[model samples]
Target: MESDNKQPCQTALYEEEETLARLTKTANFQGASGINQQSLNFRKDQMCDSPAERILKQLHNKQLLIVNPKRRNGIILYKRYHAEFAGPGSAVGVSLDTDCQKILPVGNLDLISPESADDRQRAYLIRRQWVRLTLQITENPEPIGRAQKIIEQFEGFFDSATIAKLPDEAFSLLVGVLPHTVAKVRGKR
Candidate 1:
């Protein structure tokens, strides 16, 4: 169970959507001095005018967008996925959720064993796959439940099939059903 803190620029971009809206409307971002302090602000020295400014920088660095903001196409999440590998001896495999990349106060639920050779081998394949899973709520331990559900679901479609055993189509299928179920995300609220 983890959440992504990988792309700060991405984080900034989404978080600053409202600010960007204001900036686009007014074509101005004077930072802390501006009336929209609730959504936008400038730190001391002000290396950049806004989060949008930094997002542009990151986009350019990644070559996802051009240097010109006037003609720039914003970065879009074309695809989102959780990294996973077949956990040996279990019908379910280990996965790293797009959200779970940090070690928060999430409860104890260790699915991967360090002692097992297969576990170590799987982990060694992708060290950055999972950092931790934090549940946030002490009373509600739903995160663990969520993880278990993911494993259970994965096992439904795939069982003990190593990456090699799976077909080319399997990857695409996994993309649809992730370590965290997608139905809850795209389903009716």
Candidate 2:
């Protein structure tokens, strides 16, 4: 029985290698040995800011945070009554209708990851940089549709259980909908 599973795993691995080889050929990717250390260092310096630094810069600039898609990190922005959840590839703060990016008192957000507790703690220390995005849904012709679009954007990156943890109030606050309305749309899930 174990060998049966192993056989399929081996076949999948081989297929993956073949696909990678074809991609490399098509992209003209020279092997790792061809890249010099100076080029690698320059690229790293340009693109690899410490995670905390990146978060700070985004919030400070009031830039809609486009979370790194390759990472599993998620962030939550908490207000007095609600908290917004943003997963990878989702924009967390700032919206078109409003320029409210207040992050007063700094304990308003948390970055979560499946990694070690140390990483979670590190994120907490950087919570002061967290910014809240205020979106005005009433201005939209279809308020409910606007709310649903916001909900779906979050749903795209998080699992059902993760979504469940976020209160209806959070979603409502995000898109300026009633909690009950958020519940109604969520039920349609």
TM-score of each prediction: 0.18, 0.36
Q: What lDDT tens digits, residue by residue, belong to model 1 across residues 1-189?
A: 123222322332443455556664553545435455544334221334444344334333332211111211112121234333322222112232223221111111112224456654544443322212111111234544444344344445333442224332233223433322333432312
| Poorest stretch of ten by lDDT in candidate 2 | 103-112
TM-score (C-alpha, index-matched) for candidate 1: 0.18
Candidate 1 regions exceeding 4 Å error are 1-14, 28-150, 153-189
- Candidate 1: lDDT of 188? 18
Q: Which ten residues in a row have the lowest lDDT in candidate 1?
A: 101-110
lDDT of 1: 0.31
Query: What are the Cα lDDT values of the candidates?
Result: 0.31, 0.47
lDDT of 2 by residue, 1-189 (tens): 222222211221233346545544544565545555465555445345543444444455554434333444455554445444454434444341023332211112232222455544443333322323224333566657757876776666555666777777666766667888888887844
**Runs off by more than 4 Å, candidate 2:** 1-70, 80-139
Total backbone collisions for each predicted model: 10, 0
